[model samples]
Target chain A: MPALVLNNISKRYGDVQALDGINLQIQDGEFCVIVGPSGSGKTTLLNIIAGFTKPDDGEVTVDGKPYNQLSPRDRNIGMVFQDIGLFSHLTVRKNISFGLEIKKSSKKDIDKRVEEIADRLKIRKLLDKKVRLLSGGEAQRVAIGRTLITNPSFFLFDEPLGNLDANLRVEMLTEIKRLHLHLKKTFIYVTHDQEQALSAASRVMIMKDGKALQKGPPREIYNNPIGKFVAEFFGVPSMNLIDGTIIPEEDGSLFQGAGLNVKVKGYSQSKKAEVTLGVRPTDVVVGNQITEDGFGTINSLELLGDKNQIYLTLEQEKSIIAVTSPEVRPELEERVKIKLKENRIFLFDRDQGGRLYP
Target chain B: MSERIKRKGKIPVNIIMLLPTNIIILFLIIIPTILVIWFSLVNFQPTFGINFWQSKFVFLDNYFKILMDDEFVKAVIRTVYISLICLGVEFTIGLLIASILTGNIHGKKILYPLLIIPIMIPPIVIGNNFWLIFSANGPVNQIISIILNTEFKASWFSHPKYAIIPIILSEIWHWYPLTFLILFSGLVNISTSEIRAAKILGATEWQLSWRIKFPKLKGIITIALVIRMMEALKVFDVVHLLTHGGPGTRTQTISFYLFKYGFKYSRISYVSAGAWIILFISLLGFSLALRSVLVERK
Candidate 1:
């Protein structure tokens, strides 16, 4: 059974439709991450799940039980906020055992669980210290420890590591992955940073404009995004989108636009004429030919230690980006040949931007 | 000679900038305090006006007499009692109103300023208005009569047993908004994320206040109470205008009692001694208040 399921969730604030009929099912012990830009209703969905926000219309079923009327105190779900909301008044031990205390557990049980959680989170020496005295990363661990000691059925994290420095974000990312592996509890994490989303999520749900565009494994999402927005949201150098047209032939279709031509075999029977082609930079093959069909000069180059990001303008004044290894360093404004792989290229309709599968 | 001139050129510009302010403080505060102490130390009594040279030196006599006076001791006790009762009531009611104003209710912008209207009225007007309201033929007496189901035309300001209640009510009415404003600012400053975190950790509304919010508001509550304490200890205008320390001296505070001895009866030496005692108490109260503020900062 799924650990949690949201059916037809809808919320509105004045004139803004914050969430529009969102339906999702999160499986048991699955590490699901919602990746979106700001104002995409990701945090609103999480709040609705935690019962901190009431949706206009929805049914939230947790462990196969309807939880629409349950208060956050009774929801049995632990959420860590993006701001690391550790209580400034409580000691580390008291904060960790707060949930158990509210549940009215015995004092001995509370102490044992607090010690166990502290030792697990590596905050053993900080049990008696006030939360106000802790550093940012230490406070983050205390927040996580506070949620973990409760052992809830589902965990919600709303950009919990967004405040940490880059190095510490990566470190905590690994720590969270390891914790998920050890405990096998369902984790639902939300982040606007695409790179962090790709690195951390086991299953990714790409959201835009208060709607979930696609949900799948992270690799599939990076490889095949269904819409133009999701296609652009997930890559380091986002996928280059070019407007083009497809001509159907006897056994194949030829795509031609922006000084490039490609023959695709899968959509010979398709009647689509105009299309938008999206190509990932990694799929563009570069060569030193002077008369190649898809040719452009290097406008600029960014060396990322392992790869070089090449920005080029085509013969039609169109921009395309290509990523190559560090050894293929072309000079400034040097002409280079680019090739597009027929099967790897994605075609979308011109107006609607839905993938055309050609 | 060149070295001396160089040293003189660097004569602390910041200290020179503060010179005028220091001189003003010395003249207005320090010099007057020294004169009050000198006047309290001697019997400067004169049958006629302006005879300071004929005064006799009297060491500790005025202090002892005022300290031993039954009326003075009773006034001190009454001041403390009334001040504590007002502080407790105002703080509680102000905190409640501030919480309601800060809650997600509609029309709060219009209601918030309306709550502070009592604070804008002059103190003397407040005293005189409440004096009329608690009179025998006024609306307050009529309301009390309806509540008790009896003929309650008793003058609330003239009864020895009930005179202090009207002053306490009027003062609370005039000053609760001061505490209300401070606490409302404090309430608005607490982020929503902290409350959400506490709720997800299984906190009810009452528990949220007890654990998360009340601890954060400790400093603001201390500040509000300290201000009210300072104003309450020196309170005299309302009492003088409303009751005039009548009804057998039952409603007299220390400040009101000192006015009779200082100007009416012309026991200037004893009045000065009493003023010095009150000043010492105020200094002690401020010292304790300052220590708490410093510790909270740490």
Candidate 2:
């Protein structure tokens, strides 16, 4: 059975809809991530699951039981907030033991659990210190330990490492991934960082404008996006989109725009007049021309330390980006020919933003 | 050696900037306090108006006389008792009101202004109003008669036994708002996450208040207690207006008794001595309280 199910859940704050018809099913022991930009209702969805907030309509079921009826204390769900919501007044030991104390665990059991978790988190020595005295990473660990000591069946992390510095964030991310592997519990994490989502989430739910735009494993999300929004939202430097029109050629089909013509390779039947062509920066190649029906480029290259991103402008002043190794560097304002990898290309209807061809 | 005369002399700017305030403090507060101390040591006649050099020095005689006097001793005890009782009631009720208002209730915003209206009114006005209400055959006695179904009408001001109640009630009503303001600010500053964390950690309602919120509020509570204690000990305006040392000297607080001796009986030296004794007690009490509070925090 799915460990968590959000069925037709909708939430509204006054006239603004924060969550519109969100439905998700997270399997047991699955590390699911909801990825979105700010105000995309990612935190709202997690809050609903953690029972900090209530959905305006529909139901949340946990372990096949209706969860909306349960209060936060009864939800049996552990939450680590983005703000490291540690009890500032309590000692680190007390903060960790708080959950166990609430469960009415025996004092001996509480002590054992707190110690075991603290030792694992490497905060055994800091236990007697007040939470205010702890460093950011230490406080985050204590917050995690506090929630984990309760031994809940599921864990919900709301940008748990967002407050850490670069090195500590990376360390905490790896530690969280390791903890998920060790515990094997249902984990629902939220973040706006695409790289974080790609690295950690087994399955990612991409949210935009208060709704899920696409949901898939990271590879599928990066390679075969379902729409223009999804394609542009993922990947570093993002996918470059070119506006062009499809035309009927003598033999098959050709896409022509801005004094550029490219043979549409794989589509069996294409009659759409207007479409957007999308290709990742890494896939677009710049080299000498071998054919008459391929797009040419007026290239401008930028050095990005290890690699270079060459901007290709066509005759109509339209630009596309191509990622190339710095060793194969193009000179300043060089004229180069371009080829779009047919299999790596993405096509979407201009009006609806829906994917037409992958 | 002649080159040293050419160097610019240091200007005392720190003293310059503070000179005005320092002079005022010394003249208005510090000098009068020192004069009070000096006056308490000397005996003066009505003819010799506070010329301490001409007046014979009578060290500790004023203190001894006031300490041994039965009326002065009773007044001291009554004042202490009344102040302590008023402080306790005000602190407890103020905390209760603050906590209740902190919760999500319907009329909180409206009730804040309404509750503070009583505190904003002048203390003398409140005293007079309470005096009228607690008079013989007044509202309090009428309410008591209807409840008990008896014709027991005791004069609150005239009877020494019933006099302390009115003073306590008036002081409580006037100063409870100060306590409420302090504690309310304390409650607002407490981290809501701590409360939520406590609940999720399985703390019941009682534990949440006592363990989480109360500890967080210790600093503000100390501030509130000290301020309230100081205000209570100097309980003069309301008592003077309500009873004016009463039908006898039952409700004679230190300040009112000082006023009676200094202005009414023209015994300035005795009143000054009494004032110094009260000041010493207040200073010592605050110092001890602060020391204990700090030591306990360790």
Point to the candidate with the largest lDDT: 1
lDDT of 1 by residue, B207-286 (tens): 88988889888888888889888888877988998888878899899999999887887777778899999889888987
Instruction: Return the TM-score for each candidate structure.
Output: 0.91, 0.88
TM-score of chain B taken alone, candidate 2: 0.87
lDDT of each: 0.86, 0.83
Give model 2's docking category.
acceptable
Q: A38-120 in candidate 2: lDDT tens per residue?
A: 99999989888877789999899988899897877888778888887787767999999988776677999999988999999
TM-score of chain A considered alone, across all candidate predictions: 0.92, 0.91
lDDT accuracy of residue A30 in candidate 2? 94
Chain B TM, every candidate: 0.88, 0.87
* Number of the top DockQ candidate: 1
Interface Cα RMSD in Å, per prediction = 1.3, 1.8
Give the DockQ of candidate 1. Answer: 0.63
- Please identify model 2 stretches exceeding 4 Å from their true place: A242-276, A288-321, A332-336, A349-352, B1-23, B44-53, B69-73, B149-152, B291-298
Model 1 ranges with Cα > 4 A deviation: A243-275, A289-291, A304-306, A315-319, B1-27, B45-50
Q: Between which residue pairs do clashes occur in model 2?
A: A102-B202
